[model samples]
Target chain A: MPSLIWFNEDSLNPEHQMVKDYADAPKVYVFDAPYLQAQNIAKHRIQFIYEALLEIPSIQIYKGETVAVLLQLIKDLAISEVVTTETPNHMIKGWQNELQKSIDLVTYPEIFPVTDHSSPRRFSRYWRKHERSWLTV
Target chain B: MMQQLRTDLELADREAIATYLQSEFPFVEDSGELSPHVGGRTAGLVRLQSFRLEKYGKQRNFLDGEVSQLSPYVSRGCLELEELRQWALKQSRSKSVEAFVSELAWRAFFHLVYEEEGDRILKDMEKPKVPMNQHQRSLPEDIAAGTTGIPSMDTLIHMLKETGYLHNHARMYLASYVVHFRKVSWRAGADWMYSLLIDGDFASNHLSWQWVASTFSTKPYIFNRENLERYAGSLLPGDPKQGDPFNYSYEELAERLFEGAYMPEPSGRSPGQYQ
Candidate 1:
C-alpha cells in the first residue's frame, strides 16, 4: 500500500511537506485535458506549467482526465493513499471527493492561513486583522 | 489511460516543452515564440531578487511601473506569499513595502472569497450596485477581436493576448470599458481576461472585474481621458482626440453611461475614480 504524491498546478513546490514526507513515493503531475478545455486555458499558461513540471525531475507528467488517470494509477500500483496540496478550485475539490471514496487522501493545508469564516468581508479589515501578525514575524 | 508526455525533464528545455505541448494540445494557440517570461523556481527567485520594493508603492498604479510581475509565478505555486513578504521586509519597512504587501494581501483576500463563494464567484455575488442586467450576456465581435476603436483598450487587449501580461491599472480600465461603456456582462469580460492572462487566477481576475463592475464592491470604477493620459502616458500616442469616448470628465461619462441612475458628484485628481 505505497502512497503516491499528486502535484497539481497550485502545489508544484518540490520543497513542500508532501514531497518531503513522500520522499520515495511515485509522484505524478497531470495536465487535465477536460479541465483545460473547460477553462479554455491557452498556450502561455500551459507552457508556464510545463516549465514548472520540468523543475521537479522526479514526477511523471501526463495529459489525460486527471481523476480517472490518478485512480487508474492507484489501482495499478496498489496505492493506498493519495497526497496533494489543498487548492481552492471547485473542480479540484470534485476530484478530491471522487478520489477520497477509493483511497485515503492526505492534503496539505492551504499555503496561506485562511478559512472561510475567518475571511473579512473587506480587504481593509482582512489587512487590519493580519497586518501586525505579518509585520511582527 | 494517461498518455505520459514524452519529456525527460532533465534533458528537456523550453523548445522541448513547446514541442511536447504542440503535439499533445494542438487546439491551444501556439503563440509561436511561446511565453517571453521564463518559468521554473530560478526565474521566480530572480524576479524576487530584482523587485523594487520602494518604487512599487509610489509607482505601481501606472502603466509603466515597478510592478513585480510575479503573479504568473505565484499563480503556479512556484513562488510563495510568505517568501515574497520576507523578501520585501529585508528590502525595507517603508510605505512601499507595505503597499506591495497590501497588493499581495489582495490576492489572498480574493482566494478567501473564492473558497467561501466557490463557483458562485463566477456569478454576480451581490446585486450590482447599478442597473446592468440588460448588458450583453456575451462578448461582442469588436471587443472580442480587440478592434474596440478605443486605442488604449485595444492595445491592452493585444498586449494581453500577446504577452499574457497587463498592468493592473490597464486591467481596471479594460474591465470598466467592457462592463460600463460597452454594457457587456462582467462575467463575459472576466472570463475572457481570465483565460488569456498568464497570471490568471479565477478569483483575482474575476473578483477584480466584479469590483470594477460594482458587483463585488460599493461603487463601479471608471476613468476619464485626463486620468488615462496621466497614467497610460507614452504607452499610447500622446495625441488624444477630442471626440474620443473617454475624453470626457468623470461626471460627463457617468451621466453618459449610467444616466438617470443615482450617482455621487464627479471628482478626480487622477486617471480614474470609483463613484
Candidate 2:
C-alpha cells in the first residue's frame, strides 16, 4: 500500500488517469515538487518525503543526487523495509544494509516474466522448458 | 513475506528462493552467520557501474574477466538495481552507457513479467503448445569441462567454471552454442549456468538464455567458432595464473578504471591480430 510513490509532477500530466483514478483514494500523496503551488509535506509518524532538485555539474553528481533523494525518501517514509530485485549491482544492497538495523527489508524477485512476485521460479522454469512469451503489462 | 509468495508459487521454484535471499539478506561482510537459508553477498553495485562505464561494451567480449564480476554481489542482494540505475544515469550521457543501463533494465523487464503474470510467464506457449523436448539432455563431462574442441567456447566455458564469471559477449555466444549448435534446452543451459556461476541471477541468466534460445528473439542466434576465436581475449586484468587471482586483481582493475588512470587492453587480440 503506497501513501505516496514518487511521481514527476512537472512531467506527469495532472489530468493523467492514474491521478483521477485514485482521486478519492486515501493514504495517497502526490509530490509535484518542481511546480509546487503549495507545500506538500505531510505529518506522519512513519514516513515523510521531502522533494528537491539539485544543480550538479556532472551526470555522476546528479546520480549521487538521486541516491540522496532516495535516502531522503527512505527517511521520510520511515521505511522499515525495502524491497527490490537482485541484479549484478550492489548500491541498493549497501543502502539496505545501512538501513537493515533500523527495519525489515527484502528484494522481491523482479526478473519473473510475470509481475506477481509469487511464481518467479515456476515461471522461469516454465518459460525455460516451454518457450513461453511473457506478456508485458 | 517473500516466503509467503513462494508458498503461493511451487516447490521446485529455486529462482524465487534465490531472489528472496538476494533482496533481504544482501551481502554485508558482517551479514550475520552463514546458513542454509541465506545466499551469499549482493554488494558490488558501484563496482559494476565502474565496469560498464569503463569497459563493458568496449572490451567485455575481448577480455574474459575484466568486468566487475558483479553477478554474485547482485544475486546475493549485496547490490541493488535501482541504485545502480540512479548511479549510471548520474554519470553517463552516452548511448553506450545507456546500453549498459538497459541491460539492467532487461533484468527488470523479465522480473516485471513474472510480477504481472505469475505462473503464466513460465509456460512454454503464450497459450499452451505441445512440449518441444520434455526429455532432458545431459552434456558429457569433457564438454561440461569446456573441452568441446572449440577454443572460443571452451575458453568461454572454462572461464565460467574457473572464475564463476563469463564476459557478457561470451555469455551470449556460449548460450547460443548450447541452444542452437548443441541442441540443448535453454533451461538445461540455465541450470548448468546456475550451478556454476556465483552471480547467476534468474532474470539475467534465464532471460538471456531465452534470448539465445531464440524463444525471446525475433532472429535466431548462432555463434560460430570463428566468432569466439576472434573475441577470445582474457577478461581479467592480470593473468589468472597469478596468486589469489580473483581476490588480488579485482581491486587493481577497479582502481585503474575508476581513477581513469590507464586504458586497459581491448577484448581478444590486438586490432592487427584480429584483422
Candidate 3:
C-alpha cells in the first residue's frame, strides 16, 4: 500500500519526522479555506502559511475543504496510507475524524517533546517532574 | 472544489510568493510581502543559530530587548524547541539558557493544555478571579482601527497589524488595556490578536489573554502608569498626567477597573506564570 503524507498547519517544518521518513512518498498541504474564512483568519495568517509552504519541497498545495481534498486524492491517487503529524487544531482534528471513516489516519507524535511523561494540569507540577532531567539530560 | 496552487516558479523571492498568494488565494487580501520572518526549514535553522541566551534573560522584558526573533518559525514548527534547548545547553549549562528554555516551556505548557484538555483551552479553564460579570464581549472599533489616541495602546495595535509581532511587554499592555481597562472580554482581544499575528498560536495567544483577564490564573495581570512608563515610557508623554486612560496609580486603576470589593492577589510567580 502506497503512503500519502499530509503536512497539516501545525507541522509545516521541513525536517518533520513524517516528512523525513516518507521522503519519497507523495505529500500534500491544504490551506483549508473554509476553516480560515470561518475562523476570521486574517490575511497575515495566510501570508505566513504561504511563506512557510514555500519551504516544503515537492508537496502539492491546495485551497478548499480539507477533508474533501484528501478524500478526492485518496480515490484519484489510490492512496492506502494517509499520514500527518499531531496537532491540537480543532479543524484538523475534525478532518482527521472524518478521514478515519474511510482510512486509518496516521498521526505522529508532536515534533517538540518536553518529556515522554504525561503533563500535569499546572506547569509547576510538569516542570518539577522534569526540571532536573531537563537541566541534566 | 479543491483548487491546486500554482507552482510554476520556485517562489524563491518575496515578489514571487506575493504574486502566487494573490493568484492562489484571491479571497485573503494580500498586505504586501510578509515581515522579514519568511518561513522555511533553512530560515528556521538560521533563526535558532542567532539565540542570545545571556542577553535574552535580562533584556527580554523590554520593548528594545534582544529577541532572537525565532517566534514565527517556532510557532510554525519550522524549528524544534528541544533542538534549541540542547543547543543552548551546549553553549553553557549555566543559568543563561534557563530563562530562554523557560519561555519555550511556556509554549510547551500551552501545547500540553490544548492536547490534554482538547479544545477546553479555548474556554475559561477556571472562573474569573476579578469580577467580570459586566465586561463587554466586543472589541471596540477604536482598538481595531489602531486609533485609540492613547499612544502606547495605539502603537501596540499598529505593531500587531503592520508587523504581526509585538514585544511581550507590549502584548501585556495592549491586552491589559483591552481586557482590564476597556472592560472587554479577553476572548475578543485574543481573537483579534490571534487573527492578525504572524506567529499566532491559539494555545499561546488565547491562554495568554486568559492570563491577563484572570480567567485561567490566580489573579488578573494589571499594569499601572509607572509600570507602563518604565517599559514603554517613550510611547507616553513626559508628563504622566497626559497619559490619558492609563494615567492613574495602581491603587486607583484597580479601584476603577474592578467592580465588586475583593482582595487582590500580588500576582506572584507560579511555574506556569506567563513572562
Candidate 4:
C-alpha cells in the first residue's frame, strides 16, 4: 500500500487535526528526530525525508512546510501526487509547481465541494467561482 | 544582534503593553503594581476584566483612560482572544459587543493568512498592472520616532515611544499617514513596528499596515484633523473643547489616487511543475 505522511508543526492545523479533517485515512506517520539539536531538526528532517524518498521510492508525502521548506521537500520527496485545500496566499502555489514536474498535484478550492474545482490545475490558472453543479462533484 | 536589539526589543514589549493599556483603560493615570496575567497568574486579568463591562465600549473612543488595554496581551497570546470574544458575546449580544468580537476575529484572520502563506506575506510579488517608479523608499526616522510634528499624532508617537502602545484609532491614523501622506513603503513601517512593538506578531502588524496603506484593503483609509478631534474630543481632560476642531498643521491632503497599493506581496518564485 502507498504510505501517506503528514508533516506536523501544530499551526492552525496539526497532525491530529489533519487526521480528523481529511476524509481519507492514510497511513499517518509523525517524523521524529530528537538526536539532532532543535535548531537543526527542521533542516535535518528535510534531508532525512529526501534520502528516504530516494531509497523507498514508494512513500507519498503531503506537506505544510513554509514555502522555502516546501521547495526542498518536493525535490526530496519525489512526490507524484499532491492533494490540499487551496491557499489564497501564493507560497503554497510555488510548491505545487515544483512537484508538477514529476508528479500529479491536486487541490480543492477553499470553498470546497460547493466551488467547481478540478485537480491538476496550476494556481495561476485555477479560476475562482466555477459553476455550482460542477463543484458538487 | 541581541545587544543591538536589546533596547529595540524591550521597547517593542513596552510599547505593546502601553498600547494595550491606552486602548483598554483610557482613564487610568497611574501604572501601579499589577500581577502577571499569564503563566498561571490571574491577578492582572481579574483587575483588567473589572473594567470590561463599563468602559470597554463606552470609553473606547476616549483617548485618555476609557478603553480596555488588553490588545497587546490578546495579540501576543498572553491572553486568549477566544476567551475575550466569548466573554464579550455573553456580556452583551448587541452590535457594539459584536463589534469587539469581530475585532478579535480579524486577529485570527491575520494569523490564518500567515499560517497559510508563511514568509511570502512579506515579499512583493505582484507586478502592478500600471508601471511607475520601482524604487523602494527608506522609512523616515521622525515618523518612526513619532515626531512627524503633527499634534494629533503626538499621542500615538508618545504611546509608541514612551509606552509601546498606540490607540487603535491612532494606529489607523499613523498607518494611513505613513503610507499615504509620507509616501513611505508599508514594509519599512511594518519592519520598524515589528522591531519596536512587543506585541508585534508578523501577521497582525503587517496586514494592518497594509490595510491602512490601502495595500491590503480595497478602500483607501484616511483621517482628517476634524475627524480626529471629534473622536477624541471627550477623552482629553479638563477643557475638553481645547485644540483645533477643524484643521491641524500636518501633511497637506493630496489627490493622487495611487494604484497597486493594496495587494499582498507575492510569495517566492513558483516552481515549474504545473499540471
Pairs that clash in candidate 3? none
lDDT, candidate 1, equals 0.80
Worst-scoring 10-residue span by lDDT in model 2 chain B: B1-10
Q: What lDDT is reached at residue A123 by model 1?
A: 76
Interface RMSD per candidate (angstroms): 2.1, 18.5, 2.2, 17.3
**Residue pairs with backbone atoms closer than 3 Å in model 1 (clashes):** B227-B271
lDDT of 3 by residue, A99-127 (tens): 99999788887645464437775666777
Q: Model 2 misses residue B273 by how many Å? A: 23
Candidate 3 off by > 4 Å:
A111-118, B29-33, B234-240, B260-275
Candidate 2 accuracy as lDDT: 0.41
TM-score of chain B, per candidate? 0.93, 0.60, 0.89, 0.66
Which residue runs of candidate 1 sit more than 4 Å off their true CA positions?
Answer: A113-116, B9-13, B238-242, B270-275
Query: What are the DockQ scores of the candidates, in order?
Result: 0.62, 0.03, 0.59, 0.03
lDDT leader: 1
Determine the TM-score of chain B of model 4: 0.66
Tens-place lDDT digits, model 2, residues B1-275: 01111123222343443344344323211122222221222114335545756555565446543455554444433445545556656764664455445555555656555445443333331311112263246654655777776555676676666555665666776775676556566677776775455455445666667665545543234433344445654332222343321122323432432233222243422121100
Q: Give the docking tier of candidate 1.
A: medium
Query: How much of the true A–B contact set does each candidate keep?
Result: 0.58, 0.01, 0.53, 0.00
By summed lDDT, the worst window of 10 consecutive residues in model 4 chain B runs over B1-10
Q: Per-residue error at B66 for model 2, in Å? A: 6.0
Runs in model 2 deviating more than 4 A are: A1-137, B1-57, B64-68, B117-136, B233-275
The residue-by-residue lDDT of candidate 4 on B26-86, one tens digit each, is 3333333221222111322654566554454555554654556666555433345545655
